[model samples]
Target: MANRVIIVGGGGGGAILANLLQPHGFDVTVIDKSTSHFFQPGNLWIAFKGVSPEKFLRPIPSLLKKGVNYVNDEVVSVDLNERRVTTRSGRSYEYDFVVLASGAELDYSAVPGHRELLERFGDFYSSPENSLKLWNTLRGLKEGSFVIGVADPIYKCPPGPHKGAFLASELLRSRGLAGKVKVVLAVPVPHAYPSKTVADILEPELKERGVEIHTFFTVNEVDNRENRLVSLEGEDIKFNVAVVVPPHRGPSYNISPAEVKDQSSYVKIDKYTSNVQGFDDAYAIGDCTNAPTSKSGVTAHLQAEVVAARLLGYDARYSGRTNCPIITDGKGTFVISDYDHPPIKVRLSRFKRLMEDLFVATYWSAVKYPEFWSPIFKAYFDATDEFIRRGEGW
Candidate 1:
């Protein structure tokens, strides 16, 4: 009998792991609450710009391969002793091994009257149903000061909030309100991003657009009455628009900080193996793992390769090396950045850009036109057919 495995969370890491492990004949089941798989890295870009959630979002069935089972369900808690996962619907699953890739949830309750603001103010960060909320709000606004800020320190992607601001700035400029519309950013970090070069580059980018930058400011609460966001120091900044990035926390409530989490409550795993401390059969990946790298698409894609190799008896060690091409509207250059603490930034050179373009071109092609005969790119190729061969839950 094959090893029975239950993988939790199917966004990036879980889906990739399921796709790879299925071909190897493992009895793999992927469980996630949501019906769709989101390209979250693209969500930041979708806020101001026009990118339908559907264009970026794909059905989970399209990604997994044969031998992998897909469950449109939620895992509420895990029993470490029994090595079983219990779902909110009261179903239980026992597994030989488990992978936790349940990505972070946006905590809107952290700020006062956040839900009201999210409904009224409209943020880029929203569910698939409210995808148009931010864009619709942006389109209606004729003139007003926009205040964008961080809700807390441990956000999913550190560069994304800045990305949203950068994209928003472009929107304001194109609308001819660049000078009249006041834009202020309140960042928790001392710098805009981890990279010195990118931060240096961003300073001019914001100043040129007449946007003000505030550093080391923590948004304590939102006073919707006066339309001001008050910081811990009691300083208030008014805004007509607010794009908030809430802090990220672990999905598993049962796993304690000492056992499975780091200081920030992110899953603690061996950076090389992605194996949780003291748990040999269990692995955590992507935003769920403490990889000490920027939580982005590139990080998840690379981590999938490492986790895949480990499952295949290859004993591959997860590399600390990583890169993400941060692009704005296909016109400006895509800036690349890496690391966990303070991101090490890189404006991707010609070689890197070519590689990224090739990767994107290949990735899109791989899904649409999978070359079963191709030797070089077959390993990375993925399609919906892979899961159909196994079984379709729907």
Candidate 2:
């Protein structure tokens, strides 16, 4: 009999791992709360280009390979000692190995007045509804201070706030309101971006495009009554429209061996091995894991590949690979990095922009049919590796 593998949360990491392991004879089952799997990166397109939200959504079952079982229910808790998962529906699943890929939860209520502000101004960082609402808000705006930033430092996609600011500036420019609207990006970090190498390359580009940057502007509260964002540093930024990425926390459910998780509730995993600390049979990946890397889908995708290889009895370890695509002025570039290297300074180009746009169309296939896409992905990664090794900087 094949080893039973129970994966919690059918997000990018979970789904990819299931598809990868199922064909190799693992009895894989994926449990998720939602029936639909969202292509999260597409949220930017929906907000900036007015793309329909439906384009980025797919039935969760459809994204999983035929052999993998899909449980459309919420996972309430996992008993690590017993190797059993108990769902909200009162069903229990026993597994020889388990993986957590539940991703992070966006907590709008974590910040004072943020929930109310989100209701009024909307943001593209969270859900499909909010992205659409943000599009509507942007579409109607003729001119004013458009503030885009994060309420917390440790949100998914570290570059998300910058991406939103860039896209918003581009939108205003396209609408001929560039001169009237001020695009201000206030981040909690001390630099323009978390990666100093990427920041060095991007800061000049931001200046050329007339984007204002505010570093160390950790948000204290969204003063909806005053129409300004109050920072922990005691500085206030007024805006006609403000969209701050809300704080993020770990899984909502309980995990046995409470010490397995950190204060933030993120799974405490061995960074290179992807093993949940002190538990060899259990692993964690994606936004849910406290990996020393950016919380991006690419990180999850690579980690899924690593975990799958290890489960198949092959020696594999994650290198903390992360790729974040940055789009600005109708062009794009990627901040690619790993444990051995800092982010590579790639030049912005139309080809990179096309690649970024093309991923949306190919994302579902990449997850559902990894066997077919693996070679292509390997080649892509190889090319990126070569690019990085050459010390290509712009």
Candidate 3:
């Protein structure tokens, strides 16, 4: 009998895992609450560059590979001892191996009155609808202080808030309103990015762009009436317009007898193997794992490959390597990170831009329309293997 592998989410990681395993004759089942799968990185472009959200969304049912069971329901509970999961629809599933890619939740209520503040502010980091809405808000703004604040330390995209600030600055400059606009970015971290190497490059670029950076400003509340962000230390920063990154947390059902979860409720997994602590037949990937890396789609993509290989009884392991291109006025700065090393900035060029664009299209096509992207992905996969072997050199 085939090994029954039950994946708890139909996200980027879970979907990729299903596609890889089903071809090897494993019984793969993916359960998710959403019927649509979205290209999340595209949300950044949609917010500032007016990219249509439709181009980034694909229905989940149309993307899954053949021979994989799809369950569209909410997970009720997971009994790790029994190796079983129950859904809100009264269905139960047994699994020989379990992969948790349930992803994270945006907690608007993490800060008091923050959800209400969404009515007046332009937020581009949460959802597609909000990103599109932010586009409209940007268009209507003439001249004022535009502030981008990080509400939490552990956000989905660590570089996203700075990206929004850069794009907005470019937009304001194009409109000849750069002198009239005050662009400020407030981050909870001491630096804009996680790495000092990337931060060194960004700090100078932000200064040249006339944008202000506020470090160590942990936003704890939103004063919508006054249009201000209040920090935990009782400090307040005023703004005419705001784009806030809300707090993130694990799913509500992240409870069990298993002691695999961390204090933040994320599954505690080995950084190199993606193995859930104390669970041999279980693994966690994506934003659900406390892997000491940015919780972005690229990280999830790499982790998916590692988890898939591990399940096939191979010796593959993840190395905490991923890259993100920070776009400013259609120009980009590529940031690459290797295991246990700080991210370094790579020089940008037309070739790098083309490579970035190709990856977005090829990756989505490989997962969403495999029949069309199979031949292309075969070659792309070869290149990716070479890149991985070379430690993701630019």
| Candidate No. with top lDDT | 2
Determine which window of 10 residues in candidate 3 has minimal summed lDDT: 369-378
The C-alpha stretches of model 1 lying farther than 4 A from their native spots are 256-258, 262-264, 329-345, 348-394
The TM-score values for the models, in the order shown, are 0.84, 0.97, 0.91
- Residues 154-194, candidate 1: write the lDDT tens digits: 76666666667767878887888887777788887777655
- The lDDT values for all models are 0.68, 0.89, 0.80
lDDT of 2 by residue, 207-287 (tens): 888999999998889999888999988899999999988888888899999999899899999999899999999999999
Residue 363 deviation, candidate 1, in Å? 5.5
Q: Sort every candidate by TM-score, greatest first.
A: 2, 3, 1
Residue 283 CA displacement from its true place in model 3, Å: 1.0
Model 1: what TM-score? 0.84
Q: Residue 53, candidate 1: how far off, in angstroms?
A: 2.2
Q: What's the residue-level lDDT of 273 in candidate 2?
A: 83
